[model samples]
Target: MTRRTVRIAMNGVTGRMGYRQHLVRSLLAIREEGGLELEDGTILWPEPVLVGRRAPALRAIAERHGLEHWTTDLDAALADPSVEIYFDAQVTAARAAALRRAVAAGKHLYCEKPTAASLQAALEIARLAQDAGVRTGVVQDKIFLPGLRKLKRLVDGGFFGRILSVRGEFGYWVFEGDWQSAQRPSWNYRAEDGGGITMDMFPHWEYVLHELFGRITTVQALTATHLPQRWDEYGKPYAATADDAVYGVFQLDGGVVAQINSSWAVRVHRDELVEFQVDGEHGSAVAGLRDCRVQHRATTPKPVWNPDLPSTEPFRQQWQEVPGNGEFDNAFKAQWELFLRHVVLDEPWRWDLLAGARGVQLAELGLRSSAEGRRLDVPELTL
Candidate 1:
């Protein structure tokens, strides 16, 4: 049987996340890894047309993937009847416009997180897609992490009975682009470009928090721009308008409190760059990207503190390392596979634009809370 190809028009294909995460990974998965399979003994291979501003970059990407199609024309790509899906990895500010165009073209939509710069815009995009009856999905990749998956299992299995609270530490010092090149784009340091710790990471925490504990009801946040100026790749200084760090406390439904520390200025001294410590009545679990450790009531230590004594063991060593179960794909790649399956096999994909809206809503609330020096209530979406 012949395979059904899902011809994809990829916008922002030459951008950082676009080139490294989406385009390259999707091409390899569909063409090499047998990632997408259809029901009728057919495979769902992606026929991707690279789209971007720079012709040279697009051509280079196309050549790297052995793809023949490359274009700088958005309207031309959208006009092509062969394209069934429109994928956007553009900046947060550009996603809504790109998606609006894609929906008008009658194509299924898939894209990165914080689908739009504002909550209203994100909601509008979702409503428009729903009205048009086109399938839409947003990247909620962190939920696919093996560590987070294991944490979810523990929650589901009632290991963390009567869940109490969650603490998340996520950050790594992003180079200022002086000594070493900036790991992230310069737009990430500008507010007008929809760059900030809250906008970038709150959505990730939203899904993880909702999935692991419960929905976030309220937020009290304090945001900071620790470094007001940063140097670019060439040691050219640029003013930083976005907050580099954010300290937020979320009030989840059912009295579950979650504190999240998100930053671009912190050094990674732990097992993994990101870590979540969940405490409950029955047990406590500390999960990192590489490992997850739990201490139940039965195995937890009972000790009293002494002022004049030095300990031989580090507190971190008290918990044992959890073994890796098997091979795990990159978080973004895993979600790409799931999204492709949804498009091809009619599988249920939960990470839609509505979910994306929730993320934007939280970021807005965090900013508001920080600005006003007060707690803000997060309203539920009508959609």
Candidate 2:
């Protein structure tokens, strides 16, 4: 059996998502498990060279993860023929420029979503990658989640006959840092830093909606900077120039209406940080991060609406829990493995740069819809 090693230039390892999801959970975990095994008994090992601006931070991450390579010089890393893939998880505004460099240098591309800050930039990146003949992908990690997978199974099994609507509740309170420290990075609140809840979350919504229901045909969005002032990491206050919350309604190709609420200002009163409820003619289901509950029309309870009497029905107990059919891995890691195969085995990669541009298009158009205070039709994005 032949063994091959793919060296990836992993830029932005110090950031939260890059560190935890990409590096620790996906890359290092794959290496620890003896690499990705192929069907014909070959093993493909992934060797990531940590690339960052800070030498100490890079060195520390490499050492902690028992990795062999760490480099602060991105130019040097890109110039090296040994590095076959270039990944970016930097600030949104900086992504397209870095990606241009990567594609120009003739490296396979994969990175976080909202590939660029704007649709124009995102489409340009896609075009450049196509002209360069490089394999490219953007993270669409939400669909790989267990709960959503279960929801998809129900859809495939015809459990939901003619789906009607989907309601999603996402987000929890992020402290202002006066007393409790904010869970998110301070840059997340600054518009100049390419920060906004709509920009951050719409990509997730785009992929989830397209994959499960259908393509989004139109959108109506209302965004808000709920708390205009918040404390930074240093406990110093700053005016938030970007939205912390968004309320959106999307029209899907299959006539599915999806309404989602994303907010950092609101408190969580649900089962998880994110949850989606789907209603159809035959049944209904609600899915959280790890669990899903379903109630069919046959078993669904009916309650009379009475203003004068207190309701005593066990509403929650009426739904049955969906069984976990099999082992589920980390959502990010699952996509990482598939991407590795797409790069190495010449497999069909559907979630290409074009798909990424579509996500960027949604965010851009969604913002425009909110500003215009009207429903905007979403034109199909093409390369």
Every candidate's lDDT: 0.87, 0.92
Q: What is the TM-score of each candidate against the true structure?
A: 0.96, 0.99
lDDT by residue (280-303, candidate 2, tens digit) is 999999998889999999998889
Give candidate 2's error at residue 220 in angstroms. Answer: 0.3
- Compared with the true structure, model 2 gives a TM-score of 0.99
Q: Please identify model 2 stretches exceeding 4 Å from their true place.
A: none
Query: By lDDT, who's the top model here?
Result: 2
Error of 2 at 137 (Å): 0.9
- RMSD of candidates 1 onward, in order: 1.5, 0.8
lDDT of 1 by residue, 1-383 (tens): 67777788888878878877787765566578664666677877778888888999898877877898989998899999999889998888888998999999888899888889998899999999999988888888788888988888889989978999999999999988877888888889999778998999998889889878889999999999988888866689999999999999999999999999999999998888999999999999999885799888787777768868876546666776666668778888788778888876788978888988999999989999999999999888877
Off by over 4 Å in 1: none
